[model samples]
Target chain A: MSTPSSEQEVHEHGVTEAVISYPQFLWKALGVATDGNALFYVWMTALTAVWLVGINAFAHQIVQGQGLTAMTDHVSWGMYIGNFTFAVGLAAGAVMMVIPAYLYHDEDMHDVVIVGEILAIAAVAVALAFVNVDIGRIDRLWHIIPFIGRFNFPVSMLTWDIIVLPGYFLINLHVVGYLLYMRFLGRKPNPKWYIPVVLLSIVWAVSIHTVTAFLYSGLGGRPFWNSAILAPRFVVSAFVSGPAFIVLALQIVRRFSDFYVGHKPIVTLINILRITAVVNLFLVGAEVFTEFYTGGSHVAAAEYLYFGLHGKNALVPWIWTAVVCNVVAAGIFLTVDPRKNLWIIDVACVMTLFGLWVEKGLGLIVPGFVPSTLHEVVEYLPNALEWKISLGIWALGLIIFTLGLKIAVAVFTGTMHVDAAHDAGEV
Target chain B: MSDPSRRTMLKGAGATLGAAAFARAVAPITEWTNDLSVEGFLQKHYKELTVEDMSAVLARIERETEEQYGAKVSVEDVRPTPGVQFAYALNLSVCIGCRRCAKACHEENNHDRATNNSYIRVLEMTNGSLNLEHGTVTYDHAVPAPGKFYMPVQCHQCDNAPCVRVCPVEATWKESDGIVVVDYDWCIGCRYCEAACPYHARRFNWSKPEIPADEINPDQAYLSNRIRPQGVMEKCTFCLHRTRRGKLPACLEACPTGARVFGNLADPDSEIRWVLENKRVFVLKEDLGTQPRFFYFFDE
Candidate 1:
């Protein structure tokens, strides 16, 4: 809030100076979509309406209290913290864009990268919203403020998180603002602005998830998450899952629209996915070796998550399925076939994204929280209401993302008007 | 960097006022008391407060708890009798599988009756292996069912505390008087100290603690036994609220077998000193270099 007056995208990023404001431009773009042919727009609109209805149904339930949900004593965190952790990992994905564009100096990606930063902001906001809704004591969020109703800072990691996350959100906001300004103005962004910001972002990204990881690992009794490898594992999961998601999203965009008119741009994004996915696979492989190799109490945790420890974790097959899919996604991308077919690239993206989503979103949490601290097995099943709420929120994200992109696309690719049929002649 | 959180600053202020008012109120009574060492001094932020500050902080402990916990609770100073050092020695040999000490600790600390959380755990250990390594302290099942010898576990009130070392924010620390206490509000709940503690003595409240109004301990200490928040870490404070005021811990009083003994290690003539002088007293995990105040012995 202390930051200076907002400058409109100051460069090719948005340099109309007296130019079209984003909210105005966004509405105008949405107006065109109501008239134009981006079917993603139609799905976006439909999902938004469905989300609203679901929220009404669940709001009544959540308002009456968490007593509304099926959360018994056993599954205390349940889908609430589940979705929160998932979104946090996705938000950390902003680094995928920030790291490549600024740190590694990949100038070609400069066009699409800030989208990731913007996505992170939305992810964090959504993560907070979900956590708020889950806690039911949504109004007490201000309690974290020191001197306000007793914010016990020294005693809580969640308290430390209250500080780190908002700070991360501010840093990401500033960096994206400058980058968008440079794009709008058609001027070089101050390297002074982006370079330091990127390094800070790199550490910050790792912290978001490491702190998230610490939230679980700090619980000395939860053997499933007690491994020292947890923080690094969280980082690997994020980079992989984040990029995999980008691929899925881009493919969805290309299928119904003309954005990727050529194979090269899409290919480049795929290669980025492949390299990251393969690196992710390698790390996961190392995780397996280290966990199973130790061969003791930790073995139960691994078995519980993957192969079924003492017949408790029914989610093991799902986790293993995720592992296999990720490994296969790496293989297909590495092969010559997917490289040759845009269709296959799209398919691999869909598949790998699903795998990573399942692994990070579902895999990270349920395993650790299972068999409450007292070693009693508590079942964690997402009821229809839980699914509906998550679906609604996810729809909310797609709607927000769609409108954001609708505005971003119009702003970034201003008036090219090259046969609005979009790639009628190209591959 | 000089700016502490407003919460910390105000708490610091509250603590200051409480101390000054206390010294004036009890100046005459405290005048010739040699136990008036820095142990009775003003408390420090685990980081900034020095030994002298601790001495200043302790002088003010005449239970203004009515202002804090909103109840009229008695505060008394309990010390070991002359020259007898107080150390807790549990007779694992005679420790029946009963969890009376755990129950006593819960009632003593004014824990929520429904939650029934306790600071002490009577671990049911299998004999002859001498390895508590595989023993579980979390069993809620009825005790002494089969081949099990019960061994109670609680805060060791360690002389060499790991929990105090890794705390980056200085929320938890060892008191000069051989007790460990946490500045509940200041604790960041990073739980680094929780993980650092090998004994798993620490616990975190994931939601607001709900103790029935009638059941709540009217006498509360801000850093000692007050109900903690949804996220901050908490653990056994050795009943510092009682110990500082010359009182025995509720667990010591409740151990039906007289297994638990509390006294000043500084007092050589205390019952705990006699236990040490006459019995084979041993501590848990001395190999890890944690000098635990809680000891175990077998009375033949």
Candidate 2:
């Protein structure tokens, strides 16, 4: 559990900030992404390949129309919408690190919070891409803009989503973008530029997921989503999955590059994950009990989700798997000291991420359509086309995250740091 | 002149290959442009378009429909008249599960042939049960098989319609005459309205809807049914094309048992108003307060 000390110790021992030249910093960082070992090239090429495949599939979809996918009249939304929901949660979950770092002034989380912010930007971008692809008419997207096309603001939750998601993306981009640019220039970041935005982003973070939850919850027809507890459940699960993702991502950053992510931040993150996972589990139980105990028309979706309805049990096994994974992951964190054994932390993090992905994605969306309003049980499963498109979107997000992380790591490690005293100052 | 280095040759080759690949990728778009004109692409939003613009858009749609489906169809822009509120009533006791009304609507509205995307779904329920949870929409048996009753459902055109409220682009809305319509061209095909409707009334055009030239409904309205393009949401407009023009809805006219009734609810002497006044009329999911203009009554 002892902190791994090396470059961090030296920096702390003497506050001798490495002076960097802005132009040289850019050149070095650019070179780092381009001039890499074979493995890095392979990784980048693989993602690009997948991304290109996805682009091909999406182009085919646009030409052929959405009919190529399994989405039917019964199930209007398929994999694309489900992935959008999960990505929004990932974006909102960035607030978990932000709240601790900025509000409580947790020094351990201060440096790591920017990593989460970058993640938020990537997640939001992917979520928006999903919307653009999923929609029947991308050409008509301008209709959602105010004054140009009649933007149904305030009333429509989807419009709220259109506003908040991009708004959040901009906020995170500004905060992370400014902080990194300042770091690259070897200058101190002014709090005035980012402080107010950081606070505003915290609220925007919670609102994005809450508004998304309302997109479902506000539906008068779908009883499965029309619950008072839905919003809170979304927020809680988001906190668990978002931080768990960052915890694993930080480990990758530490391993792959010279980024010095201390053990203290990981420990703090595990503590946060443990608490949120437990609360999320409790909320799941609460929803299950309320649905099963009441035994009303609304319970039709729950019955289909947990047990089979009309001999169709498509989601039954999936929901059960989610329940087991989340409960066991939370249990592991509670009992085992992940700080002592890093394996437990890694395993727990993967389990919670997978568990929440299923719980929120398919487990939330598909069942709402099952036992349709007229009470018809037509199960939905995403076809191959949807998977290809989804994989492409994910690959695109990862590519962005990888490149951003590369530049960020170079800046943080002072590999781009120059003898500013001799160079042509901060460009 | 020296031969190009390997790196230089690869760069040139890559650029050439990229251009070829880009051409291949854009081929479909070029073909689509042939069918969908640049004028169609630049068509203004339904609310923004002038009378001249709307007429031009309608002409383009008619021409395109003729070109694609090979049917000379009339696509008219039907406007709601003031002081005329539309309403519908279904007699649960008399409705046979024949689904003839649904079939007639399919043809009248020009629904897709492959999926038979009808807005109306007739649910057969066991007697003594009003619980929708137990209703079976896919009952393949004969009409009103012994112990079951039929209830055909469609857009209720609620005064405070959730579907209209949830449309992010205002693509769908309730008209002054109480008929909720979707501007097929304006809709982005997001399906938020589909998710919002409790009745599961809204249907999305998942792909380009196919219909034979002979089977295509020549009488089409812009707001009601004009063979919606791929990737937009459509629902029952209470047959606005017909009803707003002082004609009975196709479903009502096609119903054999006189179970379906359509009238201007704004008229005090209308059959729908009479049903509401005399019969024990009720709406589905009344507790949600959608206040649907469509009513159901047991023919006592």
Candidate 3:
């Protein structure tokens, strides 16, 4: 995130001479020459270990029924689905960066942009993997294919999701392969593949989360999701969170690696994050007004989300926390002094990312299902297993992202040309 | 960023030409095609069933049932099942403020073991009131204890259902004997039908249905009783398995006061026909013109 943005600001215009920068302590993370794959391997091992332990421990309880889970019928899609939707949203957001950096000549975002696409792909895969884990039947995954046994393409928003996800998968596949090839050959990417797919990928990135929004909003009966605002909420949240997600990754990398991605990219990222976060902030306001202004089922749901209702308090705290965090973080991001202050920017990024994740993941889903779709107020609380699973998935995404950035950092700086040098190096 | 849901309702019901070749066998004249130019995969909604295709689809259904749910189910094509004609007439007036129908549906449909979801919902309404706007069909609280007449609603199985009308991908459709069924495998779980349905009869299996194998009903139809895949849309099939067996729907049998009347609407002499003729019969959201075969009437 910071890597590409700072790298991007330098040579957005005409090609200039390549000048190597002194190895400032801030520039070097992960001690110049550390093994990212080795780190990734250990992290991967930890993930596998946690997954096996949790499954083995809870095997009997799951078999007995979902009593072991914090979820009852009320909060049906609690932790597992929450994590699933969040990961999917992040995947959508990552592509938001991937498309423009390579496709268009957004040279500002040149360095480390491919990492976004890679992260996006891996994120979706991880989201889907969590879904399968939650269901505990990896085999039934094939039923989604229309030709395989049966696949009801009509009437099922999930069916649309099934189509769009893999389509996005294939599109990302080509993009990733192109980037990987470029990285391996130690040259710049060809536009032939990039140009033709660029427009579709942009629209497809929007479609991924918009479709996800529709998955909930299309349900007219679910008062929580039936808002005209759900689609917009998703789009804005994605935009606001996407940049911050990138920045957070960059900060984590900066703290650990020797990827001399300077402060310029971080500032550029901060500027974008501020604009989007403020826009997202306004949308959130409009959503609150539209929902409460109407004073109907949608209003009731909004109230349920913001404040407890009917002797139930499920997501009000999380929702308000997300709202406050977003508002304050956006405020901090927009303030000139704090926006420039690297530490303040990092704090804002963390807040925005956490807020958006809670909003899109937990807030969007739980309220929509609150008082139950069947109108039963079966509030969900994630059990240890649910938490373990949720934590496990989040950890997995971070690990994937971390490993991806490390490779990206190494490539762009050494074999990895400085973000400034890479585009001109090709030219 | 804000688009009006690129997914809108498009009735591809007009593509009966190029599609005629696909189902070149069974009764095409009367079954599926009715002067509609349905486009895309929606065009492949259903071709006329040949004896072979029916057998094939039925066989496929059984195999699917076995493969998906590990239940050796019998899927009878049952082109309008014999002997006891099938009809559903809801006595909206006679329906007490009880939810016996919902309970019955939960038991008979073999709903997911975890949630115990049902195909039936009793809209608790006021007496002599027709506006469903104020009605609350989803009641988690204990029911039949207040000032409300419960109208148990399920798939209307309409002659011109909005759910069937606007399905861009025809994963669901009305049968020859006036029943609507969803092919769980063919269904993408897009929930288009759930939205288009005026009665809100359709449900989506957000998670793979968890049904105890021993509790599974072996006599399943391709469109009914089979455990649905996660991410597909499904709804009441009028209990196809039992209806074809010359038996009553679980809801009809469950009513404590026999408030429901089940008989073939096609047969003029059926008791349901008698009720439809004698009583002031009505259907949910009649102005939608769904022409639901499920009629509602009050007791005299």
Interface RMSD (C-alpha) of each candidate? Answer: 16.3, 1.7, 15.6
Q: Which parts of model 3 have CA positions greater than 4 angstroms off? A: A1-48, A51-76, A95-106, A130-137, A146-156, A336-340, A372-374, A415-427, B1-77, B81-87, B97-148, B158-173, B182-235, B254-256, B267-295, B298-300
Better of 2 and 3 by DockQ: 2
DockQ of 3: 0.05
Which lDDT tens digits does candidate 1 get at residues A133-182? Answer: 56533333443465543444655566666666777888877776565544
Top lDDT hit: 2
Query: What would the per-residue lDDT of candidate 1 be over residues B112-140, giving only the tens digit for each residue?
Result: 45557777766667776556545666667
Regarding TM-score, does 1 or 3 come out ahead?
A: 3
Relative to the real complex, the DockQ score for model 1 comes to 0.04
Lowest summed lDDT window (length 10), candidate 3 chain B: B6-15
lDDT of 1 at A261: 35
- Of 1 and 3, the candidate ahead on DockQ is 3
Judged by DockQ cut-offs, the docking class of candidate 2 is: medium
Give per-residue lDDT, candidate 2, residue B241.
91
For model 2, state the Cα shift of residue A73 in Å.
1.5
| Model 3 DockQ class | incorrect
